[model samples]
Target: MASTIISKDKFQFTDTIREHLAFGIVLTCLFLFLTSAYTKIEEHDRFMNGLLKVAFISHYAWLISWTVPVAEIVVSLFLIIPKTHKWGLYGFIGLMMVFTIYIGSMLLWSEKLPCHCNLLIEKLSWGEHVVFNLAFVGLAAFALWLIKNNQYKSLIKQNDKY
Candidate 1:
């Protein structure tokens, strides 16, 4: 019988970097995305109401609102999981795209509506909002590139041979 050892180098550089980047991005996004909710815990109801209006307030609104933070945490964990992280990264990219669009649309559509949830809106403007969204788009693009690269082929083959 022959002895063999599996090592981290078995995976291609692209896959390794993407996997790590995906995990990092998920954590960063979860923290940055939910920051408003965390900071405005005092106004949780208003925050929920805003989302409810955008997403339709049905019987599930109450539960969904409360679970959103928890759900973000779960998704972040999934992105960090070795077996499930690839697919989870794809989902994370999609989520970021949707959020970018949603926030951008809101900014464009509302010219003078009273800001509800953003605590530091007095310092914000339409341009700043767009710039913020653009930053998210850039991050999403980097993550998406990794997903499309398909960098695991080498690692998978190396493992099979070993």
Candidate 2:
């Protein structure tokens, strides 16, 4: 039927859109994580000092100074590989959530807020940083949703063919 063909075309168009959007989100997160890791590595001493200024995390600054950048790089690697893209998105979401929570906590409880680890946008206030991180979290989450939805639809299509 014409209606059926039209519906198929519509579905294909939307699926294409979703695929493109997901790809864009993945690339954006990849670039962000890679650049952030590079910046931290380049300014290792200053980054460590900034972490040391934070009252709660000052004790573990030595360990965290190395860990954070390494984790970022690992997540970037995960994002670069097609098979691991889903896990990479998960890692990205988890990292952003942690960063957002840390910033929010600092804003609420810390008497003197230390320099933020976000090398990309140093001028953003703590609140803005939270919002910024949350935005990326939302985008990544949306991309995951789209991917899941497409997989579900594919399964349904396969079932319908049987």
44-122: candidate 2 lDDT, tens digit per residue: 9989998898899999999998998999999999999987888999999999898889888899988887774557788
After aligning candidate 2 to the native by TM-score, how far in Å is the CA of 97 from where it should be? Answer: 0.7
**Candidate 1: which stretches are off by over 4 Å?**
1-23, 33-42, 49-71, 111-126, 147-150, 153-162
Q: What lDDT is reached at residue 83 by model 1?
A: 71
Global fold similarity of model 2 (TM-score):
0.89
What does candidate 1's lDDT look like per residue over 62-154, in tens digits? 675666555545656665566765566566566556645656666667444334334644366655665765676577567656655655565
Task: Tell me each candidate's TM-score.
Answer: 0.54, 0.89
Q: What local distance difference test score does each model get?
A: 0.58, 0.88
lDDT of 1: 0.58
